[model samples]
Target chain A: MVGTDTSELNAARAALVEALVRTGDEDRDAFRTVYRLTSAKLFGICLRICADRQGAEDVLHDVYLTIWNRAGAYQPGRASPISWLATIARNRAIDWRRRQARTRAVGVEDAEAVPDGAPAQDDALLAVEAHARLHHCLEGIESRQRAAIRSAFFGGLTYAELAVQAAVPLGTMKSWVRRGLLALRGCLDGDA
Target chain B: MATPDPDPDMTAAELALGVLDGDERAAALRRLVAEPGFAAEVEWWRDRLAALFADWPAVAAPAHLAARIEATLDRGAAGGAGGAANDNDHRWRTLAILASIAACVLLAVTTLLMLRPAPLPVRVPVTVTTPPPLIAAIAPTTKGAPIAAAYDRASGVVRIAGGVDVPAGRSAEVWAIRGTAAPRSLGLLPARGTARLAVPAALRGAMAAETVLAISIEPAGGSPTGLPTGPVVAAGKLSG
Candidate 1:
């Protein structure tokens, strides 16, 4: 399985970090290489949060522009390059979603009805151990909490919005997420 | 396990999860810039949780998108340089017009001196020199009208006029960007009213008519990092 190939993933991660560093030095070609290596995943992120191909495309453009401008700010020691890039993509997508929501009301009911299913079994970009550990830790949490956390992460829903969708009190939703995150952190740290 | 501090950690986790509403999110963002401990906590959450995205199926962007991005970058680079040049051209034309006016004044003075009697104190020849100070209107990107900035070339001081009400816990940071150069911080703008910021000696030479000045909303005492870490509220090119 691709996840089991630690050395290859580590090597790829190293190369991406190098490319990101080069991009920080304002190497346009390195930026292009970074784009080529990561754009698909970032585009997927944009598409999911934006829920529109055209808006995702525009958000993707802004994400790259921001990456180009903020590459120097990337701290490789603190986080993996893919995680850092994904964070930027996710934030930009969320911002786009928020702006769109302001212009036209989004159907909270429609979004809430979407099922929180198990993540499909496929090749993932994260390290095998890390991925396995996360899933294992997730398993320890309540199913509702896990589902809420997953929905929050993937759907970019605020606590109020998630509460409204789940037909639960806002404070209850917040408590579930807070407890879930604390538990997840404890488990992850314990393993280390 | 040590008992976790609920409130701050929960806030950080909420921020990292992108679940905070507008006001709460803004407050968290401010803390991210102002408090190192808070920022680190937020980063810790983000780093761990980022793995959740690994399952997202990668969708290939359209083939044309790469080309489009390259073209956009090219245009951005070219546009930046071209905008600076255009501002410079406009400055020179203004200077020429000013010089012509000075020339006419000089001619009038000379003619008056020539026509006056010798008893009139002999005046030195008037020389038309020194370009007018460069001025730029720094327009806010988010809202409100533009702020006027007047740059004195001789003094190397930029006087900014027009009030911008920075939120209680934030300060406005000034940044200067020349053609193709990264944005350099010009220090923090005052919380309210007009202020003068001196151009650094190293950057003074680069502060031409084409230079672009921007103000970004930052944490109190300005951005902890030298580079701006917040939204650029206002920006404009310098012109004489």
Candidate 2:
């Protein structure tokens, strides 16, 4: 919701949540509205993870269809509506990437990999309240955990993949993420 | 549901963070649905982790995607997606997909039927293979229907292509039979042409040069009993 003012953005956000709720009722019109408002953002996430436009398109299509079938399961509480939709897109993209990777001759994940700042490819500003909290807490944790968490979430990687890419043991990678998550929760909870 | 573990298994968190793979991923998925506390924890992890991606730079999707999805939705609403030929030729394109994915098994009659089933999400690839792939040409026994299946021992993927029309309110379950051994259910076949089935690891060994493959008509979800409870529509001996 690239609105000029906070009030307008809030209204657009509410509109999306309402539309998603209506989508549960099998309203095609409301589903279209949901698509119109969120497809671009979700498409971008899929594109980043899939690394292919056509594959991303196919993924985006599956994501929306999943939303259509699962809208009934969405809860207005617990999380932001946008966050909820974003989770579906991310999970779908990750699953798509994994399936393709497995089907096309499962290969070795390179040992000597690029550094952890690949997310720097996108310079978009964080636009939600949780964004600041997450970023702040992320900064508070150890750099290794922060980087591992970042790569795991954005890069759609598994502990095994992350371990191989970083030339570390799988247990080490898991420990980093597990400890980081506990620390992140404490930090965020302390703030809340 | 099992009481929320005392020390909180971080699987929910790992799942939310998208790092769990293979069995761990599958287990988390099962827990996600089976436990409310775990599910909420997952939602929590989802929200916090997803916040890291809130401002994914927006990119316009192709104009036709919405229409294509609408068509798929309509088809699903009419009847589920597979089994029927849709208006779009995408399925046909998928049917014609030829990527000589390597590995082999029982060979003779299954020679290149060009039995290409569309690539589907259901066919999970197991692992790399070195042995030759096996092809089973399942012909009708007592009844007349043509079905072809290719079994990759390495990957445990059984790609069944061709039509074996299922009677309404019933599903077609593929069975692997060897001699007097009881038929082992591979999985329910697609209502129409060309679909891949991942054979359970326990049943993968059942596929050999002379194993007999059969298809049976059962209740929608497959025979309630482990054994085929319906009539065998097609059966044949697989040859090398």
Candidate 3:
């Protein structure tokens, strides 16, 4: 079970909480520590969703700025600190991509470029380490809907974008994701 | 009732899912700020969907960005002329304490969960793949029965079957050769009956038309060295 295997993520989560707590207090050293530990994860999220490295880089800038500004708003027990940070990074990237949806589309050619060869290893912190129940629930859905939801979640693609990309009607894409989401919520809440 | 209008809860889910755009997203974000209940609902969705972020492969932000961010922050702090954070805020201290306590509790709870016995796997969707078009009828150079090999492209599984018998204590190892290059071991084939060998991801691309798939009988447990050591038994070229 993924639940049993979260020791490493939890340990990282624990350290992140300490760093973030100090960061909330405006401790520059702690903020630097937080960035050192997490920039790669946030950058990775931005790069995958945006696909354009430069756009992702721009979004990464906004992400850290928001993180530094909103570190005080994070509620520890309500969500893991890493999840909280990831949500911010992903949302920022999504917002950036959506704003660029019409005028500038992401280039698959840009995405194909070799990622920086530097040691970007997330130290085992970036994998889906927690949420065994959610993993189980996600597994129970149809592959197409599961795939749609996965794409929406990771790529932050809108229903229109998803439909256009998959060459399906907008309504079909919407139904696939919304129904998948509804089923997923039932599966999750049933466990809780 | 026929309309696709979603309720507030679903709207919150969509907002948290990051699937909304234009006016719909704007309204959701407005509601997120105006209504506490709506905000909580969005938070719930965000927390759950954040699980999918697990697959976000870590890419290091260019090193200079952090320094630049700090510089901009420092300038903003100095120029905004606003009071910086005051440590006297009771909420700040409380949050820091909660964070420290949560850290310890998280470690202990995770350890307890790990020690518990494994639960059964939940039912997941099975992706049934059709048999691949590329196949080879590997026949012996001399006189012997032929082994059929069908490569499934999507799954990288090569099904081998011919009902051929193997000599006692000998293994039929499969090798894939491209051009004049040396043979790469595609793992050992089953001694008898039908078996599926998962071609390694690196070798899956090698199973193209005109590529030769060969089998050899070696000491049990296949080749000790990387290259084939025993005599070749059968060989055939894969064709689309």
On TM-score, who's better, 2 or 3?
2
Mark the regions of model 3 whose C-alpha exceeds 4 Å error after superposition. A1-8, A72-78, A107-130, B1-9, B30-37, B80-240
DockQ of 2: 0.22
lDDT score, residue A87, model 1? 74
**lDDT tens readout by residue for model 3, B1-240:** 244565224787887776776556656644643354665566567667766656567787898989877876786565221111221133233333333323221122222333446779966557644544689999876798777888888777778886344567556678777644446667666545787766654455567888788776544444432335456668888998
Please give the ranking of all candidate structures by DockQ, highest first, separated by commas: 2, 1, 3
Error of 1 at B201 (Å): 23
All candidates: DockQ: 0.21, 0.22, 0.17
Candidate 1 vs candidate 3: the lDDT winner is 1
> lDDT of each structure?
0.68, 0.64, 0.64
Instruction: Kindly list the per-residue Cα lDDT of model 1 for residues A1-192, writing each as its tens digit.
Output: 232466667777877777877886778899988998899999988887788888788778766765665564343553356766777788777766765565567656534433334443453346556666777798898888887888788878889878987898887788788888888888989988
**Highest TM-score model number:** 1
lDDT of 3 at B230: 56
What does candidate 3 score on TM? 0.55
Q: lDDT per residue, candidate 2, A5-95, as tens digits?
A: 5556567777887888788788999999999988888898888777668878887887787677656434344225665567667766775
Tell me the spans in candidate 2 whose CA falls farther than 4 Å from its real position.
A1-5, A72-79, A105-127, B1-9, B30-36, B80-240
- Candidate 2 lDDT over residue span B1-240, tens digit each: 332424335887887777877656655654543354675566566556766665466789889999988988888676332212233235223322321331111111121223445446754457633667887778765556566778878877888887577766556778786544445667677666687776654455567888877777654445432345456667666665
Tell me how far the alpha carbon of residue B214 in candidate 1 is from the true structure, in angstroms, after superposition: 15
| lDDT: worst 10-residue window of model 2 chain B | B102-111
User: In model 2, what is the error at residue B206, expressed in angstroms?
Assistant: 20
